[model samples]
Target: MKKFMNFGVLALLGMALTFGMTSCSDDDPDYSNVTPPTVELAKANISGMVTTIGGKPIAGAEVTAKLGSTTLSATTNADGEYTLEGLAENGTYTMTATASGKQSVTGSVTVNKGETAAWNTRLSNEATTVSVSQTEETSVEVVTETLENNEEARVTTVTVIPAAAVEEGEEIIVTPVYSTDYATTKAATTKDFMLMGINISCSNPNAVLKAPIKLTFDLTDDVIAQIKPMKEVNGSWVEAEVTEEGEKVVFTVDAFTTYSLFINATLNQNASTEAISFAQAEYDNLYGASEMSVGTATYTYKMGSEIGQHSNLLGAYLAEILAQQMAGSTVKTVNGSYEINVTLPIGTALTLSGKQAVETTSIAAGSTTVSGKSYGKVSVTANTYNRQHNGGTN
Candidate 1:
């Protein structure tokens, strides 16, 4: 038996949202003496249709919506439609669609007031389309160059480090089954609506082995500001340490599991922000200055403004640039372990070494918590558990 860590993407949207729209008339109202209304930021809903190049709905396609900095993702239903919540109704947004064998498509949409927008997108399998094949050559040397940002006094870099390949005659199998069942039990509502997950799988199963994969990133000053390296689990980012050799960030695994990158960022601001924890909604409210919003974070005036969540995001996987890195990902095998090295932002480097594993009964059925250790939220489906295997046989 062997122990191998799994890597995967978990697009989560636990927060529910509701929005509505009202059309204004051409008539103008006199407000020379009327006081302006206050603004309260709130979450909005975004949804759309997805189809194949042949006009067929694309079920299970990965769909992600990004506004300014924050991003949310979900899978399409049987109707080839997806709905992403926990988004602020304060700005314009873009959505990306990805499927197993189709060319991915990206489009923009808007969410206003309490009103959600409807967008339609299509994926193609045409010759011009690029397939996201998991297996690509992984051996190449790397060199890097840096770029600078004047506003933030920061520098960006694009590094090209190629990982070694597996020895000849090794069987290659790639499975997408990856998970770790860790959930929040303290509160269902505050169950941490932030983060994404990825399941790592390979040709060998249930064995004590390591899967090595690398990411090639075009680092920018803004991206490095909010970067975190870890696996999201039970309301936590399980840190996995990576070394920065030149332009690459490297990781080594020894068991089946899910992985993530947690980015903590703020929304784009128009006016200078106050110490106040709210966004400045740029329009007028349905009511005068005295009108207050309840059970909602949004004021009618806050529609179409600058705003975002006040927490770290578990959402890098939804970005096209992130996916592009994997397109060039490579891995090599030695004995029973895989070697993976990638060029990406080192954000806040982390590690899983010396961390204690939870010894529990069966995994808590679904996304639920037990005692202080949550399970089922992050899961790995593998042939062998690392605790039982001895890191593959000689």
Candidate 2:
């Protein structure tokens, strides 16, 4: 048996997804008018089958293939088979197969170019109970009831939620985020993305369940700005209204199926901060300015100005590097308030050389959080890269 779907959407629960980006560089000369390079890659083809834990094919089950910013879906045919093509090539992808009146099953998949990856999983009814035990430290052990034969089936540990029928305000699921990690600033909202949706089921399979359970997630305010809870149909996201209750984001999920949040990830926003100015100080040292032109960020900056440095946010750090690293010739900053339009590809580790100058600062110092992580500030004198940071190459 494969592992069940896990949302990892407990908001600031601290279970941050780790990023892995890779790139190459040279001596890299510093020159004005440096145009950072950009790369665009595509995924490959994939096929799969869907069935119930009882060994029956599920026709018309909605299957969605997601990787990076690309999402596509197709319905299973009468034979309970489906295929998703042109997915992100040579990277990790996730597939969710769901059907009406049945609990959805999600699984992880890896696809490489020219390789047709296959995904197969068993979906269980929301009310079915399967005994569970722990196998490996990272794996769950499950024992299922008899299938067509009287033989019981042993399965692996999967993410399971205990069953409960609610009269209305009890917490059905308590998703956690790293609450201790707070951000004074955020990645300039680059491109808005709908974080993937996931399915949750009761811990015990035999327990009866109902919808309208209150769901709460602990996330930071800036991240909350990028995403909202929603239901996934076919491959599109349908917005569902959610309420902000103090430190928690609360909403109602009607079924034991899949619920996804549309994360905005608004990198560059139209706003102002009290602590930062274009050039904070004169001794700040002179590094030529740079700009990331990805989306519609309508900000402006002056060359050779005392720009804010030793920043906390990666976007800010990225901007600082671009400014001084000869990525762009002219320096630029947001004139007043606007959005940023620079694009970074998904599914790769953005490895940058900090020379160990990356430090985490206190929340009061206008620190920014990247996936619940804090890096104090790179010294204005240190932290230089060899390349133009061409949006990170693969």
**For this target, which candidate reaches the highest lDDT against the unseen true structure?**
2
Q: Go through the candidates in order and give the clash count of each.
A: 50, 49
Please give, for residues 141-256, the per-residue lDDT of candidate 1 as tens digits. 21211011111211122211122223333332321111112222211222112222233333344433323555332234334334455543446446677555554344443343
Off by over 4 Å in 1: 1-48, 51-198, 210-218, 232-236, 266-394
Error of 1 at 236 (Å): 6.4
What are the lDDT scores of the predictions, listed in order?
0.34, 0.38
State the TM-score for model 1.
0.27
Candidates in order, TM-scores: namely: 0.27, 0.27
Instruction: Give per-model CA RMSD.
Output: 30.7, 29.0
Give per-residue lDDT, candidate 1, residue 64.
88
lDDT of 1: 0.34
> What ranges in model 2 sit over 4 Å off?
1-43, 128-145, 151-394
